[model samples]
Target: MAMGVHGRRGRGGRRAPMAEINVTPLVDVMLVLLIIFMVTAPLLATGVPVDLPQSRAAPLDQQAKPTQVSLDAQGRIFIDDAPVAEAALPQRLADLAAAPAPPEGRRVYLRADRSLDYGRVMRVMGELNRAGLNHVALVSTGEDQP
Candidate 1:
């Protein structure tokens, strides 16, 4: 007779060290997430919220650095970082057009403070439209309750 304890198999199969990091799947998932964010990032913003006046206007198609027109709550107007008198808009647009480069396509972005009057917004838009800068986009903050 021999002692049975010495040669018995252990309680379970022997464990083996993991041989792979499996980074390919992780990298694929990360790359896909990065692409999704890059595609959607431009559609987001955060600031004082406003209910934008609605219109039947068609969406604009564009690919250029647009000229910006900003209106403060006090009804002051700024065009491309310079305060513009209400009367000088057309000439200013012309000046922008005369400047060098591919951005002079007469495109403009209109950003109005949420507290501003509708008539004021329309008036500024009208001025730029009359200046032959037919391409104008209203800038707005993303929907966020404050």
Candidate 2:
């Protein structure tokens, strides 16, 4: 630093404490933080990682936290993140129906891989319907496919 009166001067020509603040470093740090968040934001979404079909339809007006059913490319089934065998899905869904008031709404979101067999997806839907869970919706990515 230069040994000169760069700040407010006192009567003896000695520089007083700088009352002004330097914001350059503050802005630099803030920009770095922004970039970090921008880089990491997309990585925070956790899910079954199925390639959802693209749709132009409007999003569902969700009334409650729906049950999540997922089907992978290999035809494995999942209920709310728990693996369920194909044969057990119907009975499992029926048991879920016998629960108290909340599960009665039976808002189910069916997420299947885009490459999944259409018949397989239909079979799951059929089971959900048979179990009195008619309020089912197929989950799909928006118009843009990643």
Candidate 3:
């Protein structure tokens, strides 16, 4: 019976060792990362969430980085993530623009919430103009202006 058992455990009965890598777990991990990025992509767009009014304007491609000024729904102003007093905004921006070494283009991108009053937006623009940082780009999400 022992000899019979040994005979039964021959090369024919042996299975091949698995040398190939199972990619299912790797694929699963990659899919999980993809989902995480997809979910957080919009949130990572920029700080101070704003429902930007849409525009049919062509996309801008430029070499220089612009200074960002974002206005939230509550009318709070942020200059590159730093909150600024409305009155102090002009001087601060002007000083920042002229500091250390001036950038290639003194362009300023204004990100304003769609629900904000037009006058408020204009006022901010006026302030930006006062700062002498005149090249402005109005950021929008491409939704038609309602």
* Strongest candidate by lDDT: 2
lDDT by residue (1-146, candidate 1, tens digit) is 78565433445854555567989999999999999999777766554463674444565577776788999989988987899987787788777756764644556789999888889999888877766677787877655545
Between candidates 2 and 3, which one is better according to lDDT?
2
Q: Write one digit per residue (lDDT tens) for candidate 2, span 11-125.
A: 9988777779999999999999999999888787653364458778888776677889999989899999999998899999999877764634667889998888889899999
Clashes in model 2: which pairs? none
Provide backbone clash counts, one per model: 0, 0, 0
Better of 1 and 3 by lDDT: 3
lDDT of 2: 0.85
Stretches of candidate 3 exceeding 4 Å from the true structure: 1-52, 100-104, 144-146
What TM-score, to 2 decimals, does candidate 1 have?
A: 0.52
TM-score of 3: 0.56
- What local lDDT score does residue 1 receive in model 1, on the 0 to 100 scale? 75
| Reference-based lDDT, each prediction | 0.77, 0.85, 0.82
C-alpha root-mean-square deviation, each candidate: 12.4, 13.7, 14.5
- Residue 41, model 2: lDDT of 80
Q: What TM-score, over all chains together, does every model reach?
A: 0.52, 0.58, 0.56
Residue 126 accuracy (lDDT) in model 1: 82
RMSD of 3: 14.5
Worst ten in a row by lDDT for model 1: 5-14
